[model samples]
Target: EAGVTQFPSHSVIEKGQTVTLRCDPISGHDNLYWYRRVMGKEIKFLLHFVKESKQDESGMPNNRFLAERTGGTYSTLKVQPAELEDSGVYFCASSQRGLARSYNSPLHFGNGTRLTVT
Candidate 1:
């Protein structure tokens, strides 16, 4: 059983550049989510995916950010024309879809990828 894995581990980019972060969830997990914490803010949910479908994207800040889970295996979060406010630690997490509403599955989180936008 593998835990979540995020690529690049860290990234530094100038404003207006594009950066794509990748996450590979644990095998057999069907729920994948994206989160982030900016310097002065608490970690916030960016999006959720149940398998290959976007479950909730209400937390996304703007049009410059995009998240996708294609084929229900791995996911990618892309930030285009990155801004200073986008600098933060990006986290990816996964959990098995529970059989019942009362059953809680703990989420396995990847070591976040730190994005520095200068």
Candidate 2:
């Protein structure tokens, strides 16, 4: 019954450094998603995982970013050679597998991790 949880609510790193964000979704949820909102921009989808497989990753920004779901229980997002443009609030969400794509499904979200690249 717990909601999604994200670690390191805030992070400040230098450009070219590497940072990893973690997310633990609600138990029994089968669909996980990553999203971010850059300065002055609306939140945008980054990627999605269904169980341990990546269901969609077309929204990922670039090659420097990597996403993984371990054992279909928790997820991680790593950004290497971080750029200032990558600074934003990264959000994690989850929903039941079959209900995810439907309008009636509700996605539970984490508080989000705020990353700042200097």
Which is the leading candidate under lDDT? 2
Per-residue alpha-carbon lDDT of candidate 1 for residues 3-115, written as tens digits (9 for 90 to 100): 89999899999999999999999998999999998888899999999999999999999999999899999999999989999999999999989667323888899999999
Backbone clashes in model 2, listed as residue pairs: none
| TM-scores of the models, in the order given | 0.95, 0.94
- What tens-digit string does per-residue lDDT give for candidate 2 at 9-34? 99999999999999999998889999
Work out candidate 1's RMSD over C-alphas: 1.2
lDDT of 1 at 9: 99
**TM-score for predicted model 1 compared with the true structure:** 0.95
Q: Against the unseen true structure, what C-alpha lDDT does each candidate score?
A: 0.94, 0.94
User: How much does candidate 2 score in TM-score?
Assistant: 0.94
Query: What are the runs in model 1 whose C-alpha is more than 4 Å off?
Result: 101-103
Q: Model 1: which ten-residue window has the lowest total lDDT? A: 98-107
